[model samples]
Target: MASLSEEEQQARETIRYLVAASRSVPGGALASAREDWRAQLAWWGSQGYHGVTLPPEWGGQGKSFLVQTMVVEALAEADANLALLYEVHNTLHLEAVWRYGDEAQRRRWLPDLLAGRRLGGFAVTEEEAGSDAESLATVAVPEGGGYRLSGVKRMITGAGWYDQYVVFARVPEAGITAFVVEADTPGVGFGSPEPMLGLDSTPVADITFEGAWIPEDHRLGELGQGYAIALDLLDGGRVGIAAQAVGILAACLGRSLAFAQQRRQFGRPIARYQGIQWMLAEMATDFAAARLLTYEAARRRPEGERQRPLYAMAKWFASRKAVQHALNAIQIHGGRGYLRKTGVEHLLRDSKVTELYEGTSEILRLVIASRLLNGYNWDSI
Candidate 1:
């Protein structure tokens, strides 16, 4: 195993404190989880841990990608909901502005985002177009000095709650273009929150843009660049999801092992049974491998390497492993796992969403296949 550096060690300590704080909160479900996230965000901002990845010009810590990975892993181990919030805010919203927005746009938004005064979200998913993102029908027509956007974005994380959204809409002549739209803009309305299988604490809803208008300066990057931005954001978000899976798997394994060691069957602890021992050994192996793959993807980011294949592989495998491990944990607990009080049931529900979001397992396989068949050099392997 590799040793963690001084900074990484400090980050781990911070995460331990954050996790302890989260456990002190009263409720165990998603709503309470989101509230806990907000509290942590405020604390992180006050502690100067907000802008660890942005440029110095943007009031950021100006740290490297490795630091971002460390922070994300630490947060996920504390609370997956908070980790997802940070991922979407930094990688999708703040990074988009930094990477593609004009000078004025960056100056206007990056400060609040990095300061943790504003929350950001990316609006790309639609009811008819989930994985087939390019098939979106959202239209942004030129109107006077700006554009009028009219469409619906479904299943948007932080939809109604976020302060701002980076939206992608199709233009007549320029093709798909990205825009920075405020949540309170005219004609922008949010639907009721959707009842999801998991991650319910991180609010998701349908956002309707009925002729919402924004100045031309709000455009991000060149026209027809929305697809590129979306892909890039997903690449980063996938790694965050993989980290969440690792945390969940660790929790599951710990609980299952404790149960096996205490619960007796036939006047002997279940941990003595060969069948239970084998199950635990397999779970531990899966957890270790998944963590390695996720960290490898994180390390590749700073080198300007195209890690789409590795990112997909890690997200797919980690999510699958998390789901399977949660089920096995439930089986080990027998009937107790079925109850909400045990909390294993919540893990089981949450594990499924990791596979469904950030590109489904099937979509990730296709991405990996395309990269392999394109004749890209695999010398790094």
Candidate 2:
């Protein structure tokens, strides 16, 4: 990887400062739990980092994806929950609007979103559709100079809290279309947050739309272009997810190493044992590989090539590697790793979700195989 330019270095320092502030809040890990997390995110937005990647015309710093990735990685290393917030903004909201929204639409929403004056979310997943996004049942029908949206969106991160959301709904003849729905829209409502195995700090819930109405101008991109927008956005989002995994693995390895050097077993430090040494070696190897793949994907984007396979590979590999690293860290700590206060247990629990969300391991494998066997030639693949 190339050395960070001066601007990138400054952005990194800013993220580090934010991380320090985040950890200083009362309640530690519990500080960001539930509604409190929204407050925290709003506070970060107040600091003017919310639109760092948006173009200058839109009140953003106008930085490249690399800079955004660096900021996310730094935040993840400091606090994974904060990193998740950035993912919600950068991947789900910012990228979607930038890619799909028309000039007027961008001018209307980008400023507030980029300035952090408001929060945004992406609503796509449903009870019947997860990986198979094209099979989504949410429907949008043409109406009086606008569209009527009706459907249920499940497990949307920051759903109830965000001020705005980019929702996807199926159009019978035209296919899926993306719409900009305001939180206060007449027929938009959200359910209680669903309990999750991890990321409890980041709220997730189901959203229901009953006769929701939005102007046709709110549509993101042309009709029937929602799937393309989603795929491209996910490709970008995958890099962020991979970065989160790297941060988690790094944290696990650091904790495990410290424990190994201090804990005594068989009348000596466990770090002296060959078994412990081998486990550490494997963890280190995987962490390095995952990081490289992630950065490589980030780097490949500027070359005008689609990074679908690379991003999928990085996301899948890093997520799996993160889980294993966390589990190994647990083994190294024995009973201490099982304790919630030790933090290793939480890391392990949190690591598992990385593989399940975004794209599952199985889904990514199919994507990789398709890319390889067909050389990404859709006509043949």
Candidate 3:
């Protein structure tokens, strides 16, 4: 584990207790009413989770990203999906405001968001664009004093339920523009939630913007700054996801270690078997290295130096290891791990998405490679 300061250790312990107190099995919530999950999210955010790294003036702890990461890792140990909701809401939405929003705009929105009174979401992904910014299809047409935006954004995390969304659209007069789109906007329609493998409590859907009129005051940053804002969000999102991967790995290791000691095979605990021991050892080693990389990325993000490549590296390595560790966790548990009630399978399902979401593994690899080819020197690499 990375060297934790006294405060970080306390943050971890506090979040662990809070998660345990408010957390419930996501499986049951999936079958239960939506309020079951929504209420749990509210309770979780009330613990200062949603604003882990936000400014103190907005009811946040004003902690560093590292401290926020530790809290995320701890909460994810109990509920990864809930952690996902908090991560996107903080890193993607609130961070955007802190980075781009004017003082008046911040005053208008930050309090509710930081207090978890209103939910926030990001809507930028499109079918055609996927991970390629050059293929953006959403458009913002200038009107009297605002913009008429039209586009379809898919795979939005809080699509049908969020109170607000920071959406990206191509501006006719400039390049890409970022807008704070309220849920109540006329012509702003949400498609039915799509069924997902994991993170069942968090809904993802397609948002269709059909001539949605947005005031100029709603624009985040400035005209033609949407692409940069989107990239900025992804950088923070990657760190959050990396911390999430660390949490998954930590949970997997803990579960596997406990299972290995308790379960028996051939009249002996599986932990006594060399084969199982090897798997456990490898899992621990890989997790340690990934955690180190994740913490380093989190630490460097505030410095603003080559963060894109560093965060990409952390996300790529940690995300892949999370999936592998979860798979090993299930294998060590034998047949029982495959069962839904065991929760190991849930980890696997959740870990797989870490590879595919945020900045996808393929995109990260390309980013690293491109950066390297452009003379990013690293003798260590």
Question: Tens digit of lDDT per residue, candidate 3, span 303-345?
Answer: 5536678889999999999999899999998899999888788
Arranged by lDDT, best first = 3, 2, 1
Give me the overall lDDT of model 1.
0.80
What value of lDDT does candidate 3 attain over all alpha carbons?
0.83
The 10 consecutive residues of candidate 2 with the worst lDDT sum are: 24-33
Model 1 Cα lDDT, one tens digit per residue, 183-251? 999999998878888775878899999998888999898889998888887887787788778878887
Backbone clashes under 3 angstroms, per model = 0, 0, 0
Clashing pairs in 3: none
Best by lDDT: 3
- In candidate 2, stretches whose alpha carbon ends up further than 4 angstroms from where it belongs are 1-14, 25-31, 303-305, 376-381
User: Global lDDT of each model?
Assistant: 0.80, 0.80, 0.83
In candidate 1 the C-alpha lDDT for residue 191 amounts to 89
* TM-score to native of every candidate shown: 0.92, 0.91, 0.94
